[model samples]
Target: MRNHYLVIFILGLLLSGCVTVQLPGGKVTSAKDVEYKQPAGAFKEIASADADKSWISANTGNTISYFSECGGKSEPTLKDLENDAFAALNESKTLSSEEVNYNERAARQSRASGKLDGVPVELALIVFQKNGCNYTLTYGGLAKSFSAEAAAFEEFKNNFKAP
Candidate 1:
């Protein structure tokens, strides 16, 4: 059973269509064929785990994480990932959360705002499937500065080109 699970995980990663990201002119690569919008403040690349990818902003303690949850007999929807994203926030730290444009957009984009561990945060999550791979772009940051950061993320999402 363990080996079976391991094989499934490996196959999932393989079928997920992972790709090496290139920083073109200091631009951050979201995914394969996905566009990147230069953010306002300086952000440093942080080490990522084997599965989920992550980054952090310099000025603010904002962090963005990219997760690809695809590759099975059945595929998951953006709304499903959006709910999972919200549930991901530590419930103990979450003060309040409400949907902010949590509707079906062009690419199933969703937004939510809340307080996490005494820090205000805004979450912008986009779920998309491209090139037989499902992807989710999650952006979390200080709510006080969320507007500006959200603008940057919005620009990036706008330029997203799926292969």
Candidate 2:
């Protein structure tokens, strides 16, 4: 059992490898190099990465649509991502109520939240120049669960990385 545990641990590290990220600000660093807490527990379901390296993410507490796609385009400006985020959220029934904005600090990412078909939803988007990709984390749940979903999504943004 001890030997097996050791092997598993080593493999885990190997699998994670060295995660490098290039923020929109042109700062290149590894995932471990960044200081952010990835939300735990809330996000439980994870699917395999597809051709574009996109996958679905789920919260342990609720069933909603959440996904992340890494790749394509090199524009890492927060403004660019913010526009994209807003457009995506436009599909929601409550776009008029959302306050979409860009975060200039800490990687200069874009975040937005609002309701869709009576359900609340939030999004976190970022661009990684090093990885040559832009990714988004979209989560939706009950109106009452908006706070929780936002918190969990924030955790994910706080710990987000690329390359």
**Residue-level lDDT tens digits of model 2 in 64-98:** 22223344224546444445445534344323222
Q: Single out the weakest 10-residue window by summed lDDT for candidate 1.
A: 8-17
Error in Å for residue 96 of model 2 = 14
Q: How well does model 1 score by local distance difference test?
A: 0.50
Residue 38, candidate 2: Cα error in Å is 7.1
Report the C-alpha lDDT of model 1 over 71-132, residue by residue, as the tens digit. Answer: 33444554555565565334323334333332123356666665454344566667666654
TM-score of predicted structure 2:
0.43
Pairs of residues clashing in candidate 1: 120-143
The global C-alpha lDDT for each of the candidates, from Candidate 1 onward, is 0.50, 0.37
- The regions of model 2 sitting more than 4 angstroms off are 1-39, 48-77, 91-106, 118-120, 124-128
